[model samples]
Target: MEYLPLFIDLKNRPVLVVGGGIVAARKIKILQRVGAMITIIAPTLCTELKKVLFKQNISWIEKKFQPIMLDKVILVIVTTNNAKLNALIYQNAEKRHILINTVDDKNKCSCIFPAIIDRDPILIGISSCGTAPILVRILREKFESLLPKSLGFLSKLAGIWRSRVRQHIVDVVLRRRFWEKIFYNGHIATLIEQGRPEEANKVFKYTLNNDVGNNNKKGNVTLVGAGPGDIGLLTIRGLQVMQQADVILYDYLVNSEILDLARKDANKICVGKRVGDHSMSQKELNQFIVRLAQKGNKVVRLKGGDSFVFGRGGEELEIISKAGISFQVVPGITAGIGVTAYAGIPLTHRKYAHSVVFMTGHNANGDNQVNWAALSDYQRTLIIYMGKINALNIRNNLIIHGRSINTPVAVISRGTYQNQKILIGTLIDLEKLTRIADYPSLLVIGDVVSLHSQMHWFGQKALNYCPTYLIAHSM
Candidate 1:
């Protein structure tokens, strides 16, 4: 952090600017946005500065830079072209321990103005610690592209909820978690991203319900799909369930982006099951879910991809059923299909595959099982979930069992997210492709994989690719 970023409420606050040139004009424009009472001291002003002075009711000193001009100022800016004058302003302000910026001269200034991205209450101040102004501008531009225009409305929504959260959630730890979950969870972020202020406000109010845990109501459980790895891929219902959850039991493959949606007040207990490590045993997890629900708290079983697919949702559902807890299932974009589609490979095509078969790579029964010979003979697209670790074995098994070695294969890592990677190969080279790709990936096998060369269009912007009609006609 080059400069400590702080938001000073300048409503009726006094601020001083030492020049009336373009630099001073720029600073004044920003201060005006925050409703600051601005005083600019200079003999003359640029047309832009004069226009702002007339429009904003800013006082003009119409004189040289004097040390006495710093009196009663809460913040100061020295934007004159003269280096000596800037240094003098910096020195004088330092004596009074006042915060001041000296235009582009970082050495002379007590503070440096950051390349600011403002959605009013949702202000993002970016600085390269004063090393690179151009870099900071570039970063600001990138953020501008990613963040939506309705962020200002979302910030206002947060401002309205802040007092309610503080009044209700007394525990500091729980409160912090609640705010973290709001930002990390996709619901609020997605609302802002899509510019839906009204819906966002509704979500905000729902999460901070005043009568949240008053009665011993039979808690409801929502089996939510966290959606591949992308937070944005989570559906509106999935985000809502996360926001109202009292406890979130999430798996290892669930992306951090999806976890960010839960209420900051919610308890997040990771039950992510790895190859050899289990955070919580199935029985303990079952008991924990029942106990939390009995306490009248909404519980969310957040799983990566579609909870019903290979996510062991049936086991959790059975436990909930026996416990007589109310539960609902929210489907997610399954990674095997989602990754392949976003990578531009359709699982089923009339020209190639007529059907798509989704299967798990690991057998929970702990046996060398799957009937490979039968699967190999099936005339359909095969999508293997949790199979990155055994890609080579799966490929060889299918080949030895009668599947063609020339069958196209695509390994997708971190599917549907910004950092997603895709590797296209053949069943014969699936092992080599696995070596180059990371885990939490999917394997797509069949003729559909050949479409990726033409269809790979997930992260690319519309302008980067030819129109779909044009591409199809060209093909």
Candidate 2:
């Protein structure tokens, strides 16, 4: 990391700028917006700078660089054309432990300017550690484009609820979850999109009461699929449950962005299972879900991918059924199809495989007890879940059972989300593939795995182009 990016609160603080040219004028404008008391020191002043000084009542000293100018200043900007003078100022500021920025001279400065995206209460700072200023600017532009223009309005709306939520929701966990849900469930996004300040206010106010009632009613559990890591992949029903939930019990594989969809007044509990880490047993988790629902709070059991597809969702459903609590299930895009689709690999194709098989690598006793001989003879696509740990063993068993070593295999880690990885190999290379791959990966084997290149389309534009083809193929 070349530079640590941070936003310094400059309200009512004194700042010094040592330049009177365009650079100084630009810095002054930004500082003035944040209500910084700016003092400009230079022998000459630009027309814009002079106008700002007169209009904004800013202090201006039409003089050369002086070391004494640094006293009583919170931040200093050396924007003069003289590199030597800027370097001198940086050295002096360093000695005094003062924050200083030398324009375009990162090496000679104590601090560097960051590409900033401001939406009033929502400020995003981006930096490339002083290595790639252009890259940082490009990233800032991309985000700025994606962010709504009315984000400032939405932020102000959220700010209005801060104190009210804190006061009304006594539980810290519930309060945090409530705010997260409000922000994540597209409430704020919708408000910004429609530019509905008044409507947004009303909606926010109504949500507070609704959330409270939802929290106090006869609690029910909804087993929700978090989708394949991407927030956009979540179903409409899944999002609805998240918005109304009083408490969310989430798994390890569930994305944080999905959890952010829950109401700010809800409680968030992590029940994810991690290898080598002590976690609540399946029985304990089931009981916990039942207990939460019995407390008259709407509970959401959020899991990764599809809840029923190797997510131990059946176990949870059984517990909820026996308890006789009101319950529902919101299916998500299962990993087998979701991951392969995103990776451009079709699980079933007319020319490749007519059928697809989804199987678990391990059973209830955590043993690789799959019928290898039968599976070897199956001329179809195979999507294996929880197979990373025993991938080598499965591969060898399949080979011994008459499966060819050349069968294509694709191991996808963290599928359908950013940071997703796709490793393609064959049965013979399974061990090497396992070593290079990370956890939470799925394995796909068969001739269908070779079609990923033509079928892949997980990014923004892929959905528009591929869904038509997929639907037509299915028909």
> lDDT tens digits, residues 76-149, model 2?
99887787888889888888889988888878777877778998888988877678888998899767755656
TM-score of each: 0.52, 0.52
lDDT for predicted candidate 1 compared with the true structure:
0.76
Measured on C-alpha atoms, candidate 2 has an lDDT of 0.77
| Cα lDDT computed for each candidate against the true fold | 0.76, 0.77
Give the CA lDDT, 0 to 100, for residue 334 in model 1. 82
Clashes of each: 8, 10
Q: Which runs of model 1 end up more than 4 angstroms from their true locations? A: 1-215, 364-368, 460-475
Q: How accurate locally is residue 262 in candidate 1, as Cα lDDT from 0 to 100?
A: 77
Query: In model 2, which regions exceed 4 Å deviation?
Result: 1-216, 363-368, 459-475
- What lDDT tens digits, residue by residue, belong to model 1 across residues 226-320? 87887778877777668767899999889886787678989998998887899888889888888887776678999998888888889988998
Error of 1 at 154 (Å): 25
